[model samples]
Target: MTRPGGTTIKNSRRLKVRVKTGKGRTVSQKTWLERQLNDPYVAEARKLGYRSRAAFKLSEIDDKFRFLKPGGRVVDLGAAPGGWSQVAVQRVKATEGKGKVIAIDMHGMDPIPGVVIFHKDFYDEDAPQLLIEALGGEKADVVMSDMAAHATGHRQTDHLKIMALAEAGFAFATDVLKPGGTFLAKVLRGGTEGEMLKMMKRHFESVRHVKPDASRSDSAELFVLAMGFRPID
Candidate 1:
C-alpha cells in the first residue's frame, strides 16, 4: 500500500484470521482479537521489534516532514509502551549521543536505549519543570504527543477528551520548544477548532492534519502537525 510519504508498503495477501467467541470472551473481545491477528501493521511491528504498531504513524509523519533530525532534542508526552520514542531515538541518533529523547508517561515503561523516561503524569504541576530540567535548560527541537484518553465508547465524549489532551500538549510545547521547532499531537477527525486552530495558525508557519496509513481506516484518529513555531514577543 502507498503511504502519504510516497513509501509503498508491500504485504502479501493472507487468509483472514478468525476468533471464536469462547466461554470467557465477549463479542467485542473476539472481534478485537480477530482484527489484531489480521492486522498487517501489527505483524510487521512484531517482526521489526517495535513496541507497538503505532510506531509507523510517527515514522510516516516524520518521513514526510523530516522534523526528527539527527542531533535534535525531542520531548514525547504520554509516551507509554515507548513506540514513538523508539522511532524518535533512532531518527534523532540518540543512541549515538547526537540527540536526546525524553519520554514522559503516567504509567511506567521499560527502558529503551538512549531514552530518558519519566514515569509521571504530565498533568501534574511539576511535570513541565521536570522535563525542562532534564533537557538541561535547553529548548526542545520537537515536542510530540500520541496521548489519547480512554475511550468512553461515546463518540463525542471521546473526541473532546482527546482534544483536551492535544490542547494541553500544545500549550506545553509552546513553553519548551525552540523557535522554529515542531509540535505534533494526535487529534480526532474534525481536526483542531476555534481558538486552538487560530492559536496554531498564529504560532506556526504551517499547520495541517495528517492521517497515516498505520491508523485504521475506520478509526477517528488523526494527527495535527504544526511546524516552524513562532513564539510571540
Candidate 2:
C-alpha cells in the first residue's frame, strides 16, 4: 500500500464494515461501498458536516505546508461537491471577508458560503476571462486542483489521462497566480516525473510530490505541490 510522503498509517483495530453482494450489485460497486462504509475519514467527514472525505485531504496538506493562509485569494478547479472549496473557505477566512475563494466546475453543486462559484467547465473559451474579471486584477495566492479523470482501471492509461488534467490545471494557474503563488494538482504515481514535473520546475521555486494520509493506502493518487511561482519574463 502507498502512503503519501512515504508515511505509514496503521489501520486502527475496529469492527470491520462489510457489504454483502446484493441483488444486481456488481463486485466493484460492493467493494467501493464496503470501503466507504469502513473508512474512518468518511465517518469523520459526516460528523464534521463536510461535503466529502476529500475535505480532510486538503486540510492535512495545508496543515503541513501552511499555504492556505488567511487573507489569501484561492482558486479551486474542478470544485464539484465543493469539498476542497470548503476547506479553502475556512483556511482563507473568506467568510470573514478577509480573503477570496473562487470555485469553478462544469457540474453543479449546492452553494458554499464565502465562495464565488462558476458553474461552467474550466475549458470553456470564456472561463479564464470570467475568473480573471472576478479577481478584479488581483492575482491569486493559490490555485489548487483535485481533479482526476474517471479511472479506466488501466494504470498507464489512467495515469496519462490525469496527467493531462494536471498539466492543463497548471497552464491555467500560470495565467492567474501571483509571484510566490502556489499550484497544487493531483497526478498519479506513474510518470509523474515526466514532462509535467519538468515544466513546473522551470516556473516554481520548489516542487514536491505529496500524498496526504487521507489518500487511501492502496491508491495511486498523489498531488504535485509547486510553490513560489516565477512568472516568465
Candidate 3:
C-alpha cells in the first residue's frame, strides 16, 4: 500500500527472530537488535549501501517536498555516520562537481566522496564560518540538521535539548542560506514553540512539519521544513 510521502508499505510476513540473551547482552540491547533485524528499511539500506535507515527519512521528505536540487550548495549539521550527507550529495549532484555538500559533526565519521566534512562541535564560534568558507563564499541553498541530543529517557528534557539544537541550526542557517533557500531540522512533537516558530514564519514563505515513514511510528521525532527564505538587511 502507498502511504503518505510516497512510501510503499510492503505487507509481507516473515518469521520473527528472537534474540537469546547472552552473558554480555542486556535485555534492552537484545530488544534493539531484534528491532533492527526486523526493520525492512534497515535491510534495504544495507542492500543499497546507504549508511543508515535514516537515509530513507531524508529521501522520503525530499521526494515529497522537492527540495535538495541539483547544483545546489547544502550544509548538514551533526552529519555523523553520513547517511543524510550521502543522500544530499546524490540529490545535489555534488559528486559530479556541479554542487557542494558541507557536513559537520562532533563525532568523527568516515569520509564520503563529494562531501567536505568537519569533525568538530557545531557550538564552536568558528564552525559556521568554516562551512561558509568551504562554500567558497557562495550561500547555501539548503541547511539541514538531523541532530538530536542523547536521550536522557526524560521526555521533556530530551525535547528541550533537541529544540535547542534546532534553534541553533536555524540561527546558523539564516547567516549562510541564500535568499529563497530551505532550512530543515528535526524536532520532537511540541518542540517548535514561542519565538522560534514566530521567527520562522516571518523569515520564510512557508513552514510545515513532516514525519516520514522511515521514522518509527512511536517516535516523537518530526522534521520542520521552512522554504523561501526572506533575507533581511
Which candidate achieves the best lDDT against the true structure?
1
Ranking according to lDDT, highest score first = 1, 3, 2
- For each candidate, give its TM-score against the true structure: 0.94, 0.93, 0.93
The most accurate candidate by TM-score is: 1
lDDT of each: 0.89, 0.87, 0.88
Candidate 2 regions exceeding 4 Å error are: 1-13
lDDT of 3 by residue, 1-233 (tens): 44223445445356788899999999999999999888877777787778988888898899899889999999999998999999999999999998999999989799999999999988898887788899998889999999988989898889899999999999989988999999999989864454577889988999988998889998999889999999987
- Across residues 1-233, which tens digit of lDDT does each residue of candidate 1 receive? 65323335545467899999999899999999999999877877787778988999999899789999999999999999999999999999999999999999988799999999999988888887888888877889999999999999998888889999999999999888999999999989654444577789899999988998889989988899999999987
Give the range where candidate 3 is weakest over 10 consecutive residues by summed lDDT: 1-10
Regions of candidate 1 where Cα sits further than 4 Å from its true position: 1-10, 191-195
RMSD of each: 2.4, 3.7, 2.5
How big is the positional error of residue 229 in model 3, measured in Å on the Cα after superposition?
A: 0.8
Pairwise lDDT winner, candidates 2 and 3: 3
